[model samples]
Target chain A: MRMSKIVRFSADVLFGAILIFGFYIILHGHLTPGGGFQGGAVVATGAALVIVAYSYEEVLHMIKKAGLMLQESAGLVMFAGVALIALGLGTTFFFNYLANSGLLFGMSVPFGPNPGELNTGGVLPLMNIAVGIEVWGGLAIVILYMLSGISKAEEA
Target chain B: MIETIIHVLVIAGLVVSAILVFHFRDLLAAALASALFSFLISLEFYILQAPDVAISQAAIGAGLTTAIFILAIRSTKRYEEDIP
Candidate 1:
């Protein structure tokens, strides 16, 4: 069932904020406490809020299952692709080849206890983002699928 | 002193919420109690300086799980029936 108008409005407002914050956590994983899984869970929670606030049909219109599945598969492929690239570079899989190599996200860290640089951590940020995307898609899809199942059962 | 007091209070609240979850016959109220327990646990994690874990717990456990449970309740019975 659909919620009250006020609840829907609040959910939309909160969803925007949570989405931004979750991305911030993912992007800053190398410098912060939160990484891919945590940030992805946060984003999925925001999506869940929107899902819960709206009816099943409304939610399906807002978020397509096919799109979410594509995102999840793409994220997994991207994560593995990064690891494979390391092997192509003649290093071990999941190697941090870009660090201090003057490439994207390649800045080296200082000795100790200093403020973190956003550009550091080699392929760590990339991996974080990939995992974040995967998790967000997977979790939101779980909730969405469950709702769909419930609706189907109701119709029968 | 205050930190210790806060810790004690949080722990007490956790116990109360956990018990309330088991005590409630209304599944919805029990779900809310469980959510409260998750929230308190997340708060404890934050106090322990594990913000990442806290955020995940708060979002997934307290927020998402509660929403899912509520949805399930909507599709089924809101109150538990006696087995016997």
Candidate 2:
């Protein structure tokens, strides 16, 4: 049976809030304690809440596995691409070539243990976003796929 | 003194919930107890100054795992079968 209206409404509200918070954690990884994996899992948890609130068929209509898989693949490719770019730049793998370049997300971190600047962390922030995307798609898909498999097994 | 008290209380709660998870005969109740255990552990992580671990635990351990377990339980029996 579908969840009650109150539960569904609360889930809907939480859904948006969780997505925003998760992205915030990812973007602020350099400045905060949370990073890609944690943020992505948090986002997937919100997706799981909405999925559990509705019937499998309804959830299937709302979220597509193909799209999630594509997102995951794209994230992996982008992460690798960024790493590879460092190599092409005559630097070592995963090198922070953009740091202190005064470019986007390339500002040098302040010396010592003071509060960090948002635009710092060079390749770290980019990698964090990429991993966040990958984990978000991968974990959500895992839950959806498991639920679908269980339901299908029950029907047999 | 207050910090110690809170730490003790959280640890006690963790122990209780973990025991309850195994003590319950109803599968659903056991799943909920496990969720409680997960939440308490996440709290412990937070108290230890690991917000990142706390967030992931709260999300994956307490949230996703509980939902998946509930869904799995819903597809089958709610009570444990006695071997005797």
Candidate 3:
């Protein structure tokens, strides 16, 4: 069931802002308060707004379930690979292997708020990104699947 | 005093919304009421100075959970059967 025009318009208007805010939270997880799960849930809420406003067929065109499934799988694989790489490097699992070592995503952050370095927090930020991707894909796919399932049930 | 008043109001709203969640015969409305309950609980978490938890609760509890409930309700009956 499609909503009123006003609802659809507002949803479209809010979607970009919500997506940006969610990514901001995800990237700044180490420096800021919100992390992967929080940011991902926020993004998923934005997708929910779109899903609620449009019909199932319209939503399918907007969000591909197969793509979401692939995204979810990729995110999980990347997260696990990132974590396991620390072990392969002869460090414990999920070690701060990149912190202050001048490797990729490695920079020293001082103790304070708003340190102003995006290239800090070592592998933590990468982990946050991986979790964010996994969560965003997982939650959005669940909503899309539920919508598709309900429409099928209605048809049968 | 102002903070205390805000806290009291949020807690009261939480109670009211929880009761409304149980009282509504319409499942969609109940899900909405639960969302309101989640929002109030999130507010309470903020009052307690846990902003991160508050954000998670507000997003997952108030937002996504409500969407999931609404979707489930779409598949089944909207209204509950009255007890004899």
Query: Which candidate has the top score in TM-score?
Result: 1
* lDDT per residue as tens, model 1, A1-156: 777999899999999999999999999998988999899989999999999889899998899999999999998999999999999999999898888987999888889799788999999999999999999999999999999988887788
Candidate 1, true inter-chain contacts retained? 0.77
Backbone clashes per model, in order? 0, 0, 0
TM per candidate comes to: 0.95, 0.94, 0.91
Interface RMSD of each: 0.9, 1.1, 1.0
* Model 2 agreement with the true structure over B1-84: per-residue lDDT tens digits: 999999999999999998999899999899989999999999999999999999999989998999899788867898999899
Instruction: Give stretches of model 3 more than 4 Å off.
Output: A112-116, B77-81
Fraction of true interface contacts that also occur in model 3: 0.72
Interface RMSD after interface superposition, model 2: 1.1
Report the alpha-carbon TM-score of model 1 versus the true structure.
Answer: 0.95
lDDT of each: 0.93, 0.90, 0.88
lDDT of 2 by residue, A34-85 (tens): 9999998888988999888887888989999999999999889989999999
Residue B5 error for model 3, in Å? 2.8
Tens digits of per-residue lDDT, candidate 3, A1-156, equal: 777899899999999999999999999998778998899889999998898778899998889888989988988999999999999999998888999988877877667755467788788889898989999999999888888888899889
**Which of candidates 1 and 3 reaches a greater TM-score?**
1
Tell me the lDDT of candidate 1. Answer: 0.93
Question: What DockQ does predicted model 1 obtain?
Answer: 0.81
Task: Provide the DockQ value for model 2.
Answer: 0.79
* TM-score (chain B) of candidate 2: 0.95
